[model samples]
Every structure is written in C-alpha cells, then in structure tokens.
Target: MNHSNLKIRARDERILVIDDDLGVGECIQCMLRIAGYESAFVTTAAAGLERAQSEAFDLVVSDLRLPDRSGIDVLRALREAGQDTPVILMTSYSSIESAIEALRTGATDYIIKPFNNDDFLYSVERALDEQRMRKENAMLKRSLKRVYSSRRIIGESEGILRVLDMIRRVAASDANVLIEGESGTGKELVAQAIHYASPRAEGPFVPINCGAIPAELLESELFGHAKGAYTGAVAASEGLIREASGGTLFLDEISELALNLQVKLLRVLQERQVRPLGSKHTYATDARFVAASNRDLKQAMEQGLFRADLYYRLNVITIHVPPLRERGRDVEILAQHFIEEHSRRLGKRITGMSPAMRDFLYSYHWPGNVRELENLIERSVILAEGSVLSLEDPPAKGTTAPAPGTAGEFLDRPLPVEEYMKEVVRRYQDSHSEMELAAMLGVGRKALWMRRRRWGLYRSGDSRREGTGKGDLKRSA
Candidate 1:
C-alpha cells in the first residue's frame, strides 16, 4: 500500500518514531512527512528516550520490542522523567501482552505489526488527536486559574479585601467553610473561588441551592439512591456529594434545610459517609463542604428553625461579604464598571454619565447591592437613546444628607441668599427670558424684572425705556 498519500493535518506537530528496523522507521517517517508532520526516526530505544527527554514532541510512536530495551521500559522512563508526550506502541501478533503492558505503563495506543497502511495512519491520527486535546485542556486549565486568581472576588473595599484574604488563607486547608451574606451579595461566587483556589482545584465544584429542592428529594440528591429506592426510580445514580469527591460541594441557602435533612447532613459531615435512599450500603465521600446562608444561622438556631450542631460543624471557617451600600466608594466604582460592561454588551457607544446622573448614582442608596446595581446599569444601557444618559428623576432625599447637627448649623448661618440669587440670575440670564424666570419662580414678570434690577443683573436684550418701571426705580439707586 502506498501510504505516502496520507497527509498530517497539523503541520507544526512534532512526532518521534522509534523502531529497531531501519526500513520500518524510515517508511513511517516518510509517511508522516507526507502527512505534513515534522518527524524524526530513531532505531534504538535509548536514542528515542534521549530525544524525548531533551526535546518536545507532540507524539511518540515506538515498537514494542527493541534490540536494547522494550517500549514498556521507554514508556516508564518517560513517565518517571515527567515527559507526558503521548506514546503509541507497535508490536507483533505474538507480543500483544507486551503491548498491553506498555499501555498500562502509559502508552496512549497500540497497533499490531504487518498492519494495513490505513490502519497504521488511523492509529497515528488518533494518538495525535488525543495529544492535541490534552494540550488544549491544559491551556484551558491555565486560563481558568488566571481568571480565578484575579477576578474571583469582586469588590476591593476594605471589608471585601479582608474577606478575600480570609478565603485565600482558608482555601489551602480541608476545613469546612460557611459563607454568610445577604442575598445578591455573591455568596456562591465566594464559594466557587474558594474551591478553585484550594488543593482540590482539579476536582469538581458542585453547587446546590438547598431551598430550591424539596425535602423528600433533598436527601436523595445529597446521598445516592438505589435503582428501586422509590416510585419512578429506574436507575442507580451517584449523588452530588459523591460527584464532588476530591473537590467542594457548595450548599447555597443552607438555612432552608429541614431538621431531618439537617441531621442527615450533619452525619455526612461527621462520618464522611453517605447511605443512599433505600440502599442497604453506604459509600464514603471526600468532598470538602462549603455551605452558604443569607440568614443568620445562629438566630435561626435560637428560633428553633435550624440545627445548632450542624451550624457549628459548618462554621469552622466563616466569610462575610459586606453589602454594596456599606462598601464605601465601591458603589460608584462598581456602577461605572457595570455601565461599561453593559454598554459593550448592548453595542452602545455611551460616552459617560451626565452631572445629574452622576449625582444621582452617588447619592442614591443601593438597597439590593452590587447585583441590583448591575441590573439597573443593564437597563439604562438598553434604554439609552443618546450619548448622554438622561436622569429620570433626582436621587431620593436623605441619601446624601450631612451628618446630624451639621445641617442645622448650615441652614441657620446662611448669609448670602440675595447674593446667591444674583449669581443664579446671572448664570441663567443668557438662556432664560424674563417671562421664563417669572414662570419658574411662580411670580409676575414685573416682579422678576424688579428682582433682577435690585440684584444689578440685567440681560443684554432688556429695554431702556424711561418709564417708572421696576428696572428704572431700582436703577435710580
């Protein structure tokens, strides 16, 4: 068979072929070159191992038996040296066991000798594809690590900074964590950040909202259920706790768990074992526990709504996220960030906030915190028609009020009402006519003319007639 027609799709990929037979190695090398891969052929296992250690290749194709050493030995040596290049083993029909042992040692695939060219090329293609997938997965993991390291915790306020510090410190340990915060304060985000930063980062990070599921099925969700556990039970399934083994299980709104379920969860935390519903056997769970609550669990305990024992077990380490209103200066920063984010999402070119809009954002109290602010920004970005954001109404009063006793002094020691009125008139004289000012002040136009004259402020278009008008009387002074 003319294998020269086969082409390697990944031209930049490097391949190393190792075999004792010079003819076979050269033939494979020619085939790989035709396939667009850059390949090297070596007739000795020792030379192959040296090349693999000193250089990087996307894949290694090795014969099962060599004059000096077997391909299994080469696989073991590469694994011991921490070289993870995917290796495909080729063997004779009599040495299938040797190929299987090579696979066990770390060979990615195996092919029999005297194989068809198509089969040989298919094996090589499969190995290369697997190598590519492995590299892509590694890159994705690195990207996820970078993202989790930087933007995992959102706010930079002192309170939030302290919380981040705590998360970092506690993430290295296996102790249980309890995240307490208000709704929309990103409790789940905190839990995920902790899991991703921990030693169990490679494992799953399972999240379940405790309040969303019913009590009858909550146990089955946390602990596996047998195939015939109950009605409509058709197949045995692994529970979330088992699925999250070697990682974290984030229980959101844990306060809503009923007392009976609480007892079951407490048992799992204590014994690290889960007995599936209606199952005769129990399985061990290694998942790290990270529970979150928007309610005060201690208060719930006192009120007999939550189990005190479970609360204590879950609260080994506690992280509290401060609400957006209490995170001074972060409100405006986060609002602006959300505005920019939503503007890009909505494909709008809004330049910036108007002075009135800025004042409203700075003065208004954000009761729903960062999540609420994000929603509002999304709405504004979608509804905006022009470059400047039109503020619908003034900010609610008392949001920016001065400290007590300061406002009283500020109001009582006022000296320049007349001076302030004169400045106001002068500032608007160009744009506002006498009639407009009169209408705004709820007075006659003549009264406005008299006030403007008394204040020594006159527009360029004012009449100079010498009748006893309010302006003439004031001008006589």
Candidate 2:
C-alpha cells in the first residue's frame, strides 16, 4: 500500500489515539501527524473519553484491552454520548467472539497489533471513507428537508384537498404510487408531499425526470454504473436507487422510458433489487417508488408507446391531479397565496387583486394548470403598479385571462395581422359572439371565422366568454 497516498485522507481530519502504553500512543500520534493529520495521544480510557467528548475528532483509534477499561466500553460510552465518529480498534490477538462484539458495537474497522504500516493505514483509510459517506448522506437529508418544507402543497379546493387526503392514506404504505396529470399540475409537488409525509420521511427523496435525460443516459442515472462500465466511465457511483434506499424515488414522466429500460425497471420492482449498468452484483433496494406522467400511460400502452406490464407495475396506486381549471376556487386561493409569498420576496406592499380579477381567474380554462397560475401571479406582483393587482400591469393582455385596459390600442392600430388578431381574440373571446367579435374588430365575419379555425382558440359549442350574453355581438364588420 502507498503510505504517501494515505497522507491526503487525514489532512483535514482530527484523530484520537487511545492506549496506556506511552510508546505505542506516541508512535501512532507521530505517524498520524506526519501523514498530515492532527491527532492526540491518551494514556487511559477515561482521558480518551474526556478528549473525545470535549473536542472534535474525525476518527478514533483505541486498543481493545485498556489498562482500566476495554475499548468496547469506550466505544459504547462515546456512542451513548451521541458521538458517531468512526473508530478503529487495535488488538494483539482476539477471539472470534471478541472481534464480532467490536463490529456489532459499530467499530468501523480493526487492526492487529504490530500491524504492517501499510495495513494500519489501509484500515484507517476505510474507516474515514465510511465516516465521510455517513456525514454526506446526513447533510443531503437536511438540505432536502429544508428545500421541500417551504414548497407546501397550497390548495383548499375539493379536488386538491382530496388529493392531499389520498396522499396521506397511501404515504404510510410501501406500495408503488402513480401520479397522472397534465403537465404543470404540480405532479412533482405531489410526489414530494408523499415522500415528506411518509414513514420513511427521514430518508432521502430522489427525483429524476425521465423525459429530461437522454435515453442513452437515463438508465445509468436511475440505476447507476460501475467503474469502467462504459466509455467516459471514470468511477463507480450509486444511482437514485441506493441514494433513496430508505426513502422514495420519484420518476417523473415515466411514460418516456424506453421499453427495454422499462423492462429492467419492472424486474427491479418485482425482485426489489437493482443492478447498476456495467456492474455484476445486484443491490437490494427498500426505496418506495413514486412515478408520475403527464401523458396517459394506458393510452401510450395502447399505441405501443409504453409497455402494459410496466404500466401496471407503476399503477399500483394511482393519483390523478385535476388540472387547475377543475379545482374550483383553488385558482383564487393560489393567486392570493402567491401574492403574499412573492410580496414578501420582492418586498412589495401588494395586498390582493380585484374581485372581478379573482372571478375572472376562476372562469378561464387554465390549460397550463397550477404552474401557469403561479407564474402569472408572480409576474403580476412584480410588474403590478398598485397594491391591488389588475390585468393591465405586466401588460398581461391577450392571455387566457381578461385584459381590461389594452383594447383601444389593440383595436386602433394596424399591428401585425396575427398579433392583432390574437390580442383581439384574447381581449374579447370571453365577452363576444362570433359575429359581434368580428364587428368589433372591423373584420369580415368570414375572416374572423377563418381565424378561429386556424388558431383553434375555441370549439364551436364552447362558450367564447364567461358571462351570459349582456349584449348581442355585432353581426356585420
């Protein structure tokens, strides 16, 4: 083993060496310092425990048999004190039972006394590696919790609250979950809610977008790859499966998975094991799988775009997120929530929107769903001129929402025909009949008819605007 290479392992780590023999303690201490580590030598278990409790140490080295107490006692003491620093036990010779006891007590590794310098270093190196992995995983968990906590699933509508109730019921189980909804209906947010609310909430929650990653790389992203598994493979890394071992793995856009990869996923689901790409050994996964798709997996399966078996595997427990339009007053609730949130963020004094504006929000078909509503509300807050939000600010005209102030300019100017037509349509679609809309725009009724067909703005039977006919739309241009 390369002792020189071992120097890098302890540069930033503090080590505690516990032994009654001054010579042995000093020897290990000197070796550790020379290898770029800060270390202390203690002559008794009491002193060792005191040092470990009082100061920070990345690793501890203790003799199995101490002058007054055993190393395992010291290990238990430290652990009982809530110290999880990795420890390596040293022994001249030990029975099998003693060795097993050391391991069961969480001693990371053991070394025989009079050990080869290289072997001693190897044991210390591995103990440090395990310690690092634990710290990193813990840090990740903390960060994930903080990030997800703020994104509370905000809604009071029947559809949304019911989805929340459904999530609560299924979260306590180990069954697979399938979330189906149109894009931007907060599918990922629902997935997060499930994970954070689950019994395994303390574990990691890893999310991967099946459609975002390329087909060639998606497999490795989910299942990971072994060292030298493919071209550009430089090191072995655990995939989402291992990362989310005790938690949840969220696979968004599950319909986008290739059939072959889908088959591999199905096998993993059945056997509860995943073999990384380019690795021979398989690892057991206790990860709860929550998959989501904007596309209809059943429809995809019928069209041969998705596998029926894989669909069933993912659909163990299904959740359908209704689009924003169907969520009743959720639009207003969400808009008000956004007002408060973004107002706090932007340091704006904005209080609320006009009631007409709120009612207008309730009437539109939110094709883009909750995400769209959130975006528009955010924009209105930032660009709004007053504390009460209205349509004219941010110039949110010609959108699905009502635009109250921009009609005159839109109608007076000979803007680009398409832009003009679209704005006029946006401003009046909810308020005018086909002929009236044509007359108001000063375009031939036949021309307006052609524009509607080309844009596919409104189906024939669908109401163009929200209210009952207050006035007849002009029939002539």
Candidate 3:
C-alpha cells in the first residue's frame, strides 16, 4: 500500500489482532495504522477472546495456531455468542482444507502468513465493505416496515377505523385477500399493510396492475416465459409469481383481466404452481395472492367479463375500503396531513389551511377519493404564498351561496367552456340528478359522470360516485 498517497483521516472501525508471535502482531498493527485504521493486538487467543466479547470491533485478525487455543475455536465462540464481527484467519501453512474450514467457521477471509501489505489492506477493505452493505440492507428493510405499517394509514373516521381493524385481524392469516374500493382509495396501501404485518413481512411484495399490461403479454408477465418463447424473447425469466415466492403477489385491477387469461390464473391459484410460457416444466410457488379492483367482481362475473371460478379462488377474504366522501372528518385530517407532508418536502413553512378552505374541502364531494385530495393539497401547498393555505373560490355574488352568482358570472363573461360547465354544475348539482344534469347539458349520462369525475364534482352521499342518480343532492355543491 502507498502510505503517502492514502488520505489521512480518523477511521473509527476498530480491528483486533490475535497472534502468538509478538513481532508479527506488532508488524500487522503498524500496517493497520498506516492505512488510517484503529487496531489493538493480544498475544494469546484467550486474552483476544476476552477483549472481543467485552469491547466492540469491526473485524478480527487471528493466527490459526495460538498458544492457548486455535483461531477456529475463537471463531466458533463468537458465533455461539451471536457476535457477527468478521474474522480474518492467518496461517503459515496454506492448505485448501484449512481454508475451507476457516470459511465454514465464519471467517471473513483466510490469509497466508507471508501476505503483502497491499493484499492485507485489500482484504480488510473488502470485508468492511461487505459488512457495511449488510447493515445498510437491514436498515432499509426496517425503514420499509415502518413505512408500510398499519399505523401509517392516516384516518380517524369510523370507516377508516373499520378498515384498520380488518387489516390487523387479517394480517395474522395466510389466506388470499381481495380488496374492493374505488380508484385512489388506498387499496394498495391496505395490501401493503397486510403483507408487512404478516409472517411474510420479510418476504417480497410484488405488485402488478392487470389493466396496465396488454392481454397478449400478461400471461408471460405473470407466469414468466422461457428463452425464445416469443419474437422479443432472449433470456428465460422467472415471472412475478415466482418472484413473489414466500411473499405477496398484489394483482391490481384484476377485473380488467381477459376471460381466457382468467382461467389460467384460476388454475395457478388452485395448483400453487406456475408453468412459464413455452416451458414444459412447472415451478411451485408459495406466494399469497392479494387482488384489488374498483369494479364489482360479482357483477362482472354475472356479465361474463370476469370468471366466477377465479373470483372465488382469490376471494378467500374480503376488505372493502370506503370512499373519501364517506370518511367525513377524515377529509380535513388527511388534508392537514398532506399539507404538512408536502410543505416539509417542498421547503415551505405552511402552518395550516384557512377555515373557509377547510370547510370547502369538507363539503366538496371527493370524486377521486383520497388521491384527489392529496393532489389538490400538494398543488395548493406548492402555489401558496402565505403561511396558511386558502382556496380560490368562485366569485360569489353573496355569502348565502356562490352557485347562482357563479352561474350568472359565467353568462356575463366569455370564459372557457370547461369553466362555464364547472360553474353551472357547481350552482345546480345540489338540486339536479345525474339524468337531469345530462339532459340539461345535452350529453349522455356517462359523459356527465366523466365530466363530474374530471372536475371532482360528485354529488354528496355518492361515496363510490356511481353517477347513476343514487346520490342525494340535498347538500350544497
């Protein structure tokens, strides 16, 4: 090692050296200091083991033959004590059997007695780097557990409390789960909570949207494909099912799966094995299935859009996530949560939202559920100039209500067509049903529903926002 070229800094990683020869032990200590490392030396294995147990060490360098005991004994003692510090064994006799024994006994590296300073330094660096990586991976897993824990789901309403209770109860079981909720209602979050809290917490959580991938490729995507299976096939692949072994496979929007593909999925669920596309062999899988959908699968099966057999196979347990509109006070609570979360991320000091803005958030029917509220709050926080956030309400003629004045203002000025429509809907949605609004707007009911969804204008009491005139319009828009 080039001592002059090396950076001079305090290396806090302490290494312990155990050798019978005082000369060799002192030499190794000098080399460690030259490399800017903290180290200590003990002449006997007994003394070395004593210091190792009492003190913290990043690594240990020990002679294979000691005056009191063999380095293998020291390694075994550490392992028995549950200490994971890496050990490097040094010996004058270089034999494959001894090297294998040292490694099997948990030695990080086995070095000959006549090794060079560069080689020694290289081994030390490699061992430390591997230990660092292991620690980092452990920390990352811990952080993910905290992030996906059930407590992370933010809400205090009865609907949210019920969902949380269900998650806690279901997390102890290995049965398959089906989550039903509208888009943006945090079905995936519930799935994550279940996986992270269950025995599969340490295992992988693989999520794939059934509607995102094409029908032709979804089979291979789920079950994997052999090399040369298709036009673009180059290498054999283990599909998401195998990847989720001992973990969870979350199939989002399972209702979008084609009828033909549904039969294949049903078979896999029943057999607990997957046959890759164009492959003769089938691999067993131990993954727990967690499927989610915004649509009603029972209705879909009745319409022949989804298979009844597959539905029963995946619906071992059911979790229904209520829409944000039904989660009354949770709306304001979530809005505040997002405000604080985004404000800190964007380097702003926003304290809270204005009282009127809070009231508006509470009153407005969140057509897109939690997702829409989060996006709106994030945008508001980004554009907010003052410490408190405020919503820019439509120019109202009076405090009684903005509906009539906002509609009249749209007629007085030539605004964008969308803005005009939004104002008109806001003014009259409380009194108008879906059919009434569609007929008055000269559009179909589906078109009216899409427009309402686009503008976040679902009528009050319309939790799922089916837009089929099921919502009560007595509440103001």
Candidate 4:
C-alpha cells in the first residue's frame, strides 16, 4: 500500500505490540514505522509484559486473547506494576465484550480484528497525543514549582532569614496566612513561595489584587456570575474561589476589600464553601487561603475600614516582610543583583556601581523598597556608558555647587514644590527621556508634558542622551 500521503505526527515514539499471531504483530509494527514511530513486537503476553516492565515505551498494543494470559490480565499487571503507558487492545467481533471490559479496566483504545489501517492509526495517534499532553503539563507544573520555590527568595538578612524559616514551618500546614508589609515589599512573592512549598504545589496558585479591581466588578470576579445573572452575562461562570479548589488562593491587599465582600469572604472561610452570584446553591471548596496587605488590619478594624472577624480568620499565621531600609547590607546585595540582571537584559556591560554611587545608595532611604531599587538599577543600566554604573542626574556627595544644568543644583536653594519640580524637569530634560523624568517626579508622562507646556519648556535639540558623557563628576571610583 502506498503511504506517501500519510501525515506523521509521531516523533520517534516507542510502541510495543503483543500478539500470539506473528503476521498481525508484524503488520502493526510496520504501520507504526510508517507513522514515524519506533516499534517492537512480542509473540506472547508474558514476553510483552516483561519487556514493557523492563523498558519504557510510549504506547502498548496487545491482542484481547493470548495463549497463556488474557489482555485484561496484562492491563491489571501493568497497573499493579505502576506503569501508566497508554494501551490499545485488538479484538474480534466475538470478543467485543472482552474488549469493552478491557477499556473499562484502563485500555486507551480498542480496535476490531478486521479494523482498517486508517482507523487503527487514528486510535494510536490519539492515545499518543494525550500521553504527550500529560507529560508536558507535568513538566510545566514542575517548572512553576521550581520558579516559585522558597529557595528562590533572594536575601540573607536576619529579618529575611526569619521570614524564610516561617515560610518553611507554615508551608506544611493548611492554615490561612496573612503577610503584612509595605507596598512593593515582596508580599506577593512570599505568598507564592508558601504556596509552592506547601503540599498543594501541584495545584493552581490563583492570585487576585483586591485593591486593583473596582468594588462593583470585584464581587463578580471573586464569586463568578452565572449565565444571565447580569445584563452582560453570556455564560455560566465558576468564580476564583471555586477555580482555586484543591489549590491556593492569594488575596493581595486584602485590607482593600469592601466591607460587604469581607463578610461574604468570612462566611466562605468559616464554611469552606462558596456561593456564586445569582446561584442559590453553594458548593464546597478545598482551597488554601493566603492573604496579604500593606496596612495594619488591627488598626483598620478599629477604624471600621475592615471587618474584625474576617481579619481574625485570615490572621491565623502572620508573616511580616521587612522594609528595605530595615534590611541592612541587603541593599547593596540586591543592588548588585539588579545591576547584573538588568545589564544582561539590556545588553549593557555594567559590572558594578562606583564607590560614590554605592555610598549614595547606602545612605538613601528606600521608601519604595526593593521594587524602587530594581527600577533605578534598570534605568541606570540603560544610561550607563562604561563597565561601572555612576550617578549622573543626582550627583554624588562633597560638591559645593551642583554640575551645570542638573537638578541637584536646585537643591542648594529653597524653592516651592512647583518651582523645584519645574527646575528638576527643565535641567534633566536634556539628559533623561520623558519616561525617566516623569518617574523621578512620581507623575505620568502626560502629566510631565502638561507641566512642561505650562512652564514653556521643551527639548532644545536631541535632548535625549544615549549614555553618561563628560561633566559626570566621578568623585571616587
């Protein structure tokens, strides 16, 4: 038969065929080869089972009846031996009942004795495809686990070491966790590490920022709406709580949750079940809860901004991630880490910071925490010319007067917030891009442009600097 038009999707997949008849076994082997698979045939059930148990095969094909043992026996034996290879059974019309039983017992597919080549090949391809998907899914889960593992947390400060220890201790339990820290203090990262380190690592890790979504839509998002539940509801939905079944649910900025939602969430925590919107019935869920907030919940409860009972429920285990200022020596470590990371990503050769720049970093108060440090390092790397990163816009210490046309020069004289900001923008506009200037001022690009227009300031000519050049004060390097 001509097989030139056959579509082969198999990638050297190993297949084993077991049959008492040599002719049928050889035919199946030949078909597997034509489909771009590697194949071997065995004459008896014992030999096939032995070979399958000894070697790894992607798929196994066996006849329903053998001289010594039946295919059902083979399936059971393989299962008992912890083998999950896909199995296909071949049977005659008279043995159709046995074939169905084999399927119920765990056979991947069944083919009749007089089955056409096309039908047989289709079953083989389908079974192999499913197995491949399972393998890929398992690999992806493993990768996620590795990426979110507690060992991946970067820091060696005492506070950070204590947090790591707490993570390890709490990961073995199913109690709800509450992580408290300032914004950008890596609270979500801690939550992820706890989830991946826990027994529920194989399950999904669903995270939702409570403060980001509006209160009106946040309810439906958390407790999904059913079909026709609202004006725009087009289909039934299973909410995030239900979707997190047998996994973990990370609620970031939980203090931002509305009071009404807090009551509903407390009920779900107490009952271990969730009721979807516009649905009368509530279903049980088995998800572990991990909540985080930058605010103090106790204070929030006293101020009537948060529910007392809900806070108590979520505070069974508390982990406080220290602010970057409190983590001494970690600043330099994280700075160097970010420098290398952003350097490689941006294709720069920045190996380290100048001594004066390092001193400036050490003295500065990191109000925005690790996130701000990483951003600064990335921006500096983008504008770095030499192998070392040096301060340009913000000049280093020990200078009577700031460099010409630099924002630092304005620091010597007192000015209003508006005028100071304007000078900073006008002086640095030549050296920095629009985005960089806006970020320094803690405003959006549009806002910066509006201010510039109000002040009648505009880029003179090629205002954007490619990298740090002459006039950059190198105090000590």
Alpha-carbon deviation at 98 in model 4, angstroms:
11
Candidate 2, position 318, lDDT:
94
Score every model by TM-score. 0.60, 0.59, 0.61, 0.62
RMSD of 3: 12.0
Instruction: Rate residue 202 of model 1 by lDDT.
Output: 77
Candidate 2 regions exceeding 4 Å error are 1-151, 399-477
lDDT of all the models against the reference? 0.75, 0.79, 0.81, 0.79
Candidate 3 structure quality by residue, lDDT tens digits, 1-477: 234344455787999999999989898888888788999999988999999999999999999999899999999998898898999999998899999999988899999978777888889989998998998997788567946576668999998999988988998898999999877789999999999978788789999999778889998899999999998989999999999999999999899888888988898899999999999999999999999998899999999898888999899999999988789889999988998999999999999977878776766545457876776677677777889877552211222123233444445565544565577677667666655454334344555666677787866565654454554333334
Q: Highest lDDT, which number? A: 3
Model 4 TM-score is 0.62
Q: Give candidate 1's whole-model lDDT.
A: 0.75
Model 2 lDDT per residue over 79-122, tens place: 99989999899988778988999999999987778876667877
| Collision count for each candidate, in order | 2, 3, 0, 0
TM-score of 1: 0.60
Residue 110 accuracy (lDDT) in model 4: 79
**Alpha-carbon RMSD of each model:** 18.9, 14.6, 12.0, 12.8
Residue pairs of candidate 1 with colliding backbone atoms: 7-35, 8-35
What TM-score number comes out for model 3? Answer: 0.61
Which segments of model 1 are wrong by more than 4 Å? 1-90, 94-106, 111-140, 145-149, 393-477
Candidate 3 residue pairs in clash (backbone atoms < 3 Å): none
